[model samples]
Target: MLSKRQSKYFKSLQLKKYRQTEGKFLVEGAKGVEEVLQSDFEVEALIGTSAYLSSLAENLKSKAKETIEAKETDLLQVGTFKSNNTGIAVVKIPGQDRNVVEEKGLILALDAVNDPGNLGTIIRIADWYGIKTLVCSMDTADVYNPKVINSTMGSFTRVNVMYADLKDYLSKSDKKVYGALLEGESIYKTDLTDGIVLMGSESHGISEELRPFVTDPVKIPGRGGAESLNVAVATAVVLDNFFRG
Candidate 1:
């Protein structure tokens, strides 16, 4: 039985305004909820249908501020979006700090990657290769965007995604910066080290303002004239080639 306030709160979380006002976001599905439960995030509430609640009985002792068990119909009633039948959990959005990247192993910087799925896929790609830190331009898609969360396939738990002024960070950074361009030295031939690999937006390559800061301008060699590759695909190719080698 959801209280009237709980109903209102769940509805509010659907909008970015409410998420910002409350400093929280929503994670859905069994995998996503399990990721949140096993992560360091502070969960606020867990609401589930009776069927879902029974499955989580062993771990449901208020991992959050409140755990409410409701009938399947009730859980579906006030759900902000289509509840995937796996239940829903709300967790505090992790506070992101860009300065931490300066001391980390390898950090990825996104210029203005606006697609939520693309950003989420890249985050998953980063996690696949153990690249934990990500710095994005302010214009990039919000990591907490539900679409992005869904796309990460639970990799969000292991990755830290932050937004910053990419140009300024690149200019001030001590790490070697490599920018992927269309007509530069082949990425296969470039010497990549433990540093930042700057990936650009979907439509455009690295922005002009930040291109000057690139220590090594590299390109992925291709045999065909396909114009270019998808940003997330390009990221996976670059990270796999460098990290697997």
Candidate 2:
């Protein structure tokens, strides 16, 4: 059973301000809770049904500072998910001091991708392509957003997402900046290489400020009449081309 204070605390994490204040975020649903438990991320607390708690290994159960047993209905009230019968974990947000750009591998970067779902899908896409790091503009959606975390389907555990000034980050790096633009060279023909693949918002595409830094502007050829691709799909398409070679 959850105390009123405890329930309130967990509920507060659903908002970004509260999450930042607490240095913690909620990982809802059974799969997300399971993945966070397995990762190196620190688990502050675990809330689940008695059966769900019992299903966890002793070592996994011990990872949390505290554990609370609750009914499925109780779990539903504490998280953003529409359904959560299994469990939810209060996880400490890891420090974001690591380098986003690597010396030898391709890095995924985002510019003003404010949609949580799009950001989350892109994180999964980055994980799929084995791209370890993702740099995002400060305006990008928070990676710790519950919707984003839920959308990753556990890929959030594997991908390193850091936010910074997109323009500045690109300017400091010597690697080629491949901007996904509609009028640019078709991604199918461009010579892909290791560098930053900068994707912009669905509505705005790449911002004008960041375009000057793009050493290579590439695009996906569209035979149909679609004006633009969803940022997440475009990212997967671009990454597929990069890793195809």
The ten-residue window of minimal lDDT in model 2 covers 95-104
TM-score of candidate 2 versus the correct structure, residues matched by position = 0.97
Tens digits of lDDT, candidate 2, 179-240: 99988999999999888899999999999999999999999999999888999999999999
Range of the 10 consecutive residues with the lowest summed lDDT in candidate 1: 95-104
Instruction: List per-prediction Cα lDDT, in the order shown.
Output: 0.81, 0.90
- In terms of lDDT, which candidate is strongest? 2
What's the CA error at residue 85 for candidate 2, in Å?
A: 1.1
Cα misplacement distance, residue 80 of candidate 2 (Å): 1.2
**lDDT score, candidate 1, position 3:** 78
Query: lDDT tens string, model 1, 1-245?
Result: 77778877876776778888898888777788878887888889887777776787466535777887765555565453465675778888766542266456888889989998999899999999998888899999888887788789889888888778887877778898888888678888888788889989868889999888888888889999897899999998888767754
